[model samples]
Target: MRVSIDSATCQGHGRCYDLAPDLFGEDEEGYAVLTELTADRDVPEGREGDARLAAANCPELAVLVHEQVRA
Candidate 1:
């Protein structure tokens, strides 16, 4: 999976970081930062769905989850 954050629409709510700290972070300015965009790393079990849920909870809809398919 791939994650992308739209800084323009973000309100610095920190919900994404709260839900998925390993995958998301907040800068000093309180904007969202995407720490991990790929699923190849070692993520704790069951956290993947939580990340998606966090993205869905964004009121501005700034977070995006993209599933990659190999050919």
Candidate 2:
């Protein structure tokens, strides 16, 4: 899974980072930031649930989680 944050849509509510600090982070202004230590920001091996929770809890709907489509 891949997760991303839309800065424009983000209201800096901090839910993403608060809920999933392992997968998300906050900028200097407390905006949602993708801090995954990977190129594609993969949702780690087992933190997929955290990512989903963060996205679902985002009041601005800024956090986005994209799962691979099954063939």
> What TM-score against the true fold does each predicted structure earn?
0.76, 0.88
Tens digits of lDDT, candidate 2, 1-71: 88888888998999988877767888898887888542377877778788889989999999888986647
Best by lDDT: 2
> Highest TM-score: which candidate?
2
Candidate 2 residue 36 C-alpha distance from true site, Å? 3.7
Question: lDDT at 23 for candidate 1?
Answer: 82
Q: Candidate 1's residue-wise lDDT over 1-71, tens digit each?
A: 56778888999998988888778889899998877543443334456687688788898999887655637
Candidate 1 Cα deviation (angstroms), residue 14: 0.8
Candidates' C-alpha lDDT: 0.76, 0.82
Candidate 2 root-mean-square deviation in Å: 1.7
Candidate 2 segments whose C-alpha is farther than 4 A from its true place: none
